[model samples]
Structures are given as C-alpha cells and as structure tokens.
Target: MAVSRLDVFYRRLLLTKLFIGGWGKPEDLKRIFEFRKIIGDRERCKSLVPKDYPVYINKTEDLTDCQIHDGFFMSPLEHLVPGILPPEAVKARFQFIVPKKWQRNRPVCIHLAGTGDHFFWRRRTLMARPMIKEAGMASLLLENPYYGYRKPKDQRRSSLKNVSDLFVMGGALILESTVLLRWLERDGYWPLGMTGISMGGYMASLAVTNWPKPIPLIPCLSWSTASSVFTTGVLSKAVNWTELEKQYAINSVYEEEIIKLLEYCGADSFKMMPNLLKNVNSLEHLLGLSGDHEVSVSQYSKTQMEAEVDGGLQGYRAGEREQQLSSVNSKGTSLDTVTR
Candidate 1:
C-alpha cells in the first residue's frame, strides 16, 4: 500500500509530540526507566522465573457462546519472592476456547490479551466464533497476569504500580505460554501457531523465539521489537518524564548517560530483533528486532539456550530442546496413535 504525503506528515508530527516537544503529557517515567533496566539486564530479568514450570487445568465447560477450558498455575515469580503476594493473586487463571467440532487435526492459535483487552469477555460469541466454526481453527486465550481474571484487587484498570510489575507481566506471559504450548503439543496438535493484536503481538514474538520448532507465527497488527513502541511512539506521550526523572534523581530526560542506557537496551541489540524476524516459518517480513538485551534476568535466562548451563537462558532451549521432543508419534506411523 502506498502512503500519502499527508499520512507521512501526520506521523512525523506525532513523533514530534513524543520527542522534541516538552515532556509530552504526564505519563509515569519511572515505568519507562524500569523498561530500560529490563533491557540492560537480560539474564537477571529471565532469572526471575523457574526454568521448568508446571500448569494445572481445573475444568472445561461448553457454553452457548464458546467452549472454554479454565485453568490456573503458580507463577515462576512466586518462588522468586515467597509469600509477598496474597494467596488469591498467587495462582494465575486462563481460558482456552475451542471450535464447536474441534477435531484431532485442527491447528491451534494462542490469542493473547492486549492491555486492558475487554473484547474477549464482552463479545465472546461475536468475536471468536467465526474463527472457530467457519475456519476450523481453535483459540487458546491467555489472560495477562495483571489483567482480566488474574487482576489484583487493588490495582486499577491496566495500571501497574512498579516498573518490575511490568517486567513480571511480560515474563509471566512468556512462561505461561510455554506451559500451554507444551500442553498443546503434548496433546498431539499439529502445525502449531501463535499471534496477538498489539502488546499481545510483542509478547507472542517473545514466546515464539523461546519455542523450539518453527511453526506458523502470525503476529497480526504487530511488530518484532517493543522499543520503538514505547520510546518513540504515541505511547511515549503518556509517560511523565518530569516526575520519572525526579524519582530517579536525574536532571535531564536526554542526559548522555540516560540516552546510552536506553540505546544499550534497544531491541535490535544482542540478536533479539533478527532472530525474531527470521525468514523460516514466520510470516514474511511483517516485524523485526531492535537492540539492547534488556536486563530483567532470571537465573534461567539467556538469549539462546546453549549460551548458559546452570539455569538455562533467554529462549527455551531453542534448537536443542525442540529436536529432543518428537513432534509425531513414534509408536504409530501416523498421528492417530500418538500418545496424548
């Protein structure tokens, strides 16, 4: 599609508002700095999670709107800091939607919730039915940790009090996706895929990179990297730089040290962008990476699985792990006899 001159001008104007102009409206800069902290310390950020995690499914019910499977699991972060979270917020819940006549051969798509996404709850039948009934595709929706069913009682709509809270949100989504992807694959579904609209799309990209095999990844209406989305996009205007600098005791938002820190954590750095935009089984040329590995490491984090030994690294064992897991049934020649 060709872009018009007016569209280009408008976009540039928006950019001006996010940057060169005064501190754009009043958004929380502390949160943005926390974002920077995550970028700078990739390994530490990933370490906040357990390398091997478990998920428990409570029940599955068939409703007039859709067949929803409800489940919950303890977050890897639960162990990182024991007993700080109340019991109610400790266990995370999720809903999985399947087509009315879900068959063995149907493909599964994990639909992630964007920030404050209400479409899934408000328009269940109208929003997801066509994808299932007409397209023969199954939908597995994961409610973000701090949003939807798992929202903490005290938290307001889609708002987090601390910067670590945001990183935890992203990490929790990645881990939960791991648990569900394992279940889907273990259940014998073939040609697996993942996708999301916006923030969901960014999280989906993170999940797929950690996944072993190259399945169809359709991150619709999204990009490969998250840096630009926050640093220079419309969202930046929402941040409160004056207060954020005050919180960190900094004088300038564009201080040389601060700029370096932000650049150091860019999504393109340390291979996050390139690996994400791989030309293998991913949708061709839709999204890309930026720089900076982002700190937020766990004892288990690393860009690739092979890079670390003690607790593992960024991506879930990438090539080595996928090879070990058999996609097809070894006992039976075809998928029919595969163990579920």
Candidate 2:
C-alpha cells in the first residue's frame, strides 16, 4: 500500500516542529541515557545485587495453556542507593512460563516489554509461548521496573514523571536483567537470548552490554540511537520536552564534571554502537557454541534503518519468528528470537 502524500507532508512538518520546539543541547541528551554511572556499565553489572538474593515463588499453578511460575527477587537498586528507589521498585518481579513439553537444552528468551506497557498489553508476549513450546523452547518474560509489581502505587500505568524517574527506570531494569540472566544461567539454559519491542529493545540492548558472554540480541522495532526517538519521533509530542530541559538545567548538565561522567560511560560515546557491536560479536559466539545463527526480524521499515530479519521486506514480515496459530498445536516448530 502506498502512503498518502498528505500524510508524508504532515509528518515532515511535524519533524520540523520537533527540531525547533524541543532540540536540547548535546549535554542534555547525556542526562537521559547516562545520568547514572551504572546505566550501562559492565563493571557495575549486578554489583548492587547481593549474593543469594531470595526468590519467592509466591504462587505456581498449572494452567490449561501452560504452567506459570510467578515470583519476585530482592531489588538490588534499593540497597544500592538508599532512599532513592520508588517503593514499588523495591522488588524485581517476573512470570516464567513454559509448555509442559519443555525439557533439557531448550532455548530461553529473556523477553522484555515496552514502556508503560502493562495489563492487556502483556498478552502480546504471553501468547508467543505456545509457539515456542512447539519449537521446544521456554519463555521467561520479565516485568520491567516501572511496570507490574515494580510500579509505584501512586504512579499510573506507564506514567513516569520527572527526569529522575526515567533514569531510575533504566538503571533498575539494567540491574534487574543482569540478576535474572545470571540466575537463568545458573539453572542451565543454553543459548539464551534477549529481545523486546520498542523501548523494551533499548533496555535489552543495555542489558546485553553488561553481560560478559555473548548471547543473542534481537531488538525489534528499535534502533541503536534512542535520542532520535525522544527528540524527533511521534513520541516527542507526548513527552514533555520543555520539562526535561528545565530538569537538565537544575541537574547542572552543562557542568564539566557531568559531561565527563557521561563520556566515561562507553567506548562508543554513548551512541549505542559499542553495545550494538558487542551484540554482533555475541552472534558470532552463538554460532560457534550452538552451530546455528537465528536472527528473526519480524517487521522492517526503511525510514527506521531496520535491517531485515528472516527476509522481511517492506511491511510484510515474512518469517517464522512467531509461530502461527495453526502451528502452535503442531510439534517440532522452532523459534528464533523473541518477537513482540
């Protein structure tokens, strides 16, 4: 289907407005992605997490579709920075689901959800498991910091106010993912991968960077550079850019120390290329260790600079990334990466 010329003109006009209305200094961008020294730091990877942090499997019940293991882990962030974490973020939560057919050496994808994504929106991930079971893999869908049990009681769904809240979300998720992945490894899940759609993709990217070993990194509907999303995408219209600018000034983003602090965050100057390259190296490692290269790009768009995964073309996502409804009941169907 062809896009209407009027819609293109409207979007271009919106982009123009975005540039003039909200473009902040380069220094301000740092505050968003690197406000915390621990945002993407491998050295601080799970450092806040303690040894033998408890996992409470409060409830486990067998369902018709699959068996669910619902649980929570101690929030390392609360301990790492006293009195700073939101009350709801004090514990990391997760829902681990697997088909009854799950057995040894099955692949597990650490599935992530997008920002403010909760309630009915979660079914998008849960529905993928039957297909995974057909392929003999397991799905571990993690609840992000600001979603599920980690959400503050006062904050509405996906409602994170203040610039500090955003930093806390990123920091907490990065740490939480590390802890979960480590636990999964200890339990012996081979060829594990991380994937998510949109902001979840960004979080997954950050998580893989801190991971020492190579694993699959599939971020559907997301790009290496997030600054563009906040500054130019349709989301810009929803986010309060002026408020963020004021917060930057208050945080002293222009201070020389602040600049140096962010610059120290990476080898790629926080453009996410270092993390992206790390993902590529991990892909090579997966090939050596598992003898299979699974890159499933479910959807593609040229304007987004998204590379094809499984021969996806234009808007037609032609691949077996997600098992079709008919295939779910069929045995021996394998899954590649986590699809949102």
Candidate 3:
C-alpha cells in the first residue's frame, strides 16, 4: 500500500508544531550515564520495586453513573536514583473510574498515556467513559512521570529536558504499573487487562513483561521496533539533533561511555510477546486474567467486542478531536533519543 497524501501532510504539520523546546540542560544526562547499567538490565530494574506498597487514596467523587477515586503513591524510582527526579515527579498520581454498581464479572483496564498526553482527561473522556458506559468496564488512568502534575517545573511544555528523562520515565512507569495491578487484584477487580495508544502502547508493552501473571495486552498503533519512528518518521523533526551532535562531538564521555551503555536497551515488541503469553494457563486467562466471574470468557469477549466496535466507531468520528489533543505538544522525549 502507498502512503496517503493526507497522512504525509499531517506528519509535516505535526513536525512544525511539536518539540519547539529542544534538548534541555546537558547536565541531566549525567545521572543516566551513572545508572546506565541498572536501566539496561531487566533483573536489576525489577529489584528496585517493593513487592507490597501502599497507594494512598486522597479522595473520591461520586458521579451520577460512576464513582471516581483519586490517589497517589511514592514512585520506586526515587529509591533507585535518589534525588535525581524533581519532587513533583517523585509522587505518582492516578485516577480510577468505577461503576457505581459492580457487574457480576468485574472488568477493569489500565489505560496508559499516549504521546503528548499530559493528564487523565484524554484517556478518561475518549476511552474510559465509553468502556464503562457500554461494557460495565472500569478504567485506571496513570499519570506518566514526565507529564501532568508530576512534570518537572523547569521542563518546557511537554518537551522533556534531557535524554535521560526518557529512561527515567520508562523506569518509573514500569514499577508504578505493577503497584496499580497488585492493588486491583487486592480489591477484587478481576479480569484485569492493560492497553494504550501509540507511546502509551509502547510503554504498556514494556510494563507487561515485568508482570508475573497473564493479562490481555492490547497496544494500539504501535510497532515491534521503535528506532524507525524516531529516525525516519515525521516525529523525527522534533528532535534537537544539532544540540545532541554538538555535545556528542565535544564530550568524549557521550561517545565513549554513554553510547556503549545504551547498547543494552531494546524496544522490539516481538521480544516481549512471548513473556506476555507464557503464563496463559486456561481459557479464562485467555479472556483476560484468572477470575471467579459467573460469566463465561466467550460471553465477556462478545461484550468486549461490541464495546470495541462501538468505541472504534466513536474513535473514527472523533479522529480530528484526538489529533488536536495529541498535537498539543511533544512531551515524549524518549521517542526523539531512540534514534541515537
């Protein structure tokens, strides 16, 4: 298939609007260089997260149809990296939307943030509300570290300061997601799953691998390898290649030490698929996760399919709305540095 002229035009327009804030303070990369070993090694990364952590529920709002619960928890990244992160980014924030009356079979999905998604509104309004309305599904929306209330004060609008910020965001999300998953299980929200769009999808893929049990992993509009998106895609225009090149040329540390450490990170989705599938032990697990629901997996799938179809139709109609929201600014610094 050939690329559409409209798509090309969209990309070009996006390039011009996004990432006006170039590569931020070069000093920020120092922490990443120091901790490159931990970032690269899966086992070392896992060691940082505490198995049993508490999520403090700050407040709850009762809606006409559903109830919204807001909460916060200390991100494990603080323990690993110490004072590297801004104070705001250290405390992770989230919103959970649940049905007033629980369905016999409770279905909940954690929706991750896409590129330029700052707060909970995009996922809540576009995805969560519909899923809850149609299928009695609940949604847990996580605030990505480098976004929303957690975003660093000094960072430019949505554009992260340094290359290391991306690594930090990834690490923080992986551990923070597990905390939410365990909390859901404890609260008896069964048939849980994870899903995200674009950048969120890639982050979801990385988070799911660290999970011990099986769950439905749905990553929308994402690919196995991310290198091309940064190197060849229109998004590439957002990168501050001139500044990075200047630093790379002047500082032998980036060339000799930092470049070598980065060789350990890879984001190929295919590599994560097996780990995602390895723990599927039965039919119900196939439907979602292990659950004691009276409803059958086939029946749940039927409901989900219907919800998805309806959601897809709505998404298509709201395509322009979504594009405007995503084009707000380029907060995803990780996508830019992936090319290097």
What does each candidate score in C-alpha RMSD?
17.5, 14.8, 13.7
Clashes of each: 42, 3, 1
lDDT of 3 by residue, 7-99 (tens): 578576553333234333445555655565554455665565666678888999999889999999998778777876778899999999998
Score every model by TM-score.
0.57, 0.63, 0.71
Candidate 3 collision pairs: 158-331
* Tens-digit lDDT track of model 1 for 143-244: 776676667676555554444355456655665676777778777776678888777877787776666567677776677555433434444444344444
Best-to-worst order by TM-score is 3, 2, 1
Give the range of the ten consecutive residues with the poorest summed lDDT in model 3.
331-340
Per-residue lDDT of candidate 2, residues 276-301 (tens digit): 44365455455563322232211112
lDDT comparison, 1 vs 2, better candidate: 2
Badly placed stretches (over 4 Å) of model 3 are 1-7, 11-47, 264-340
Say which candidate scores most in lDDT.
Answer: 3
Tell me, by TM-score, which candidate is best. 3
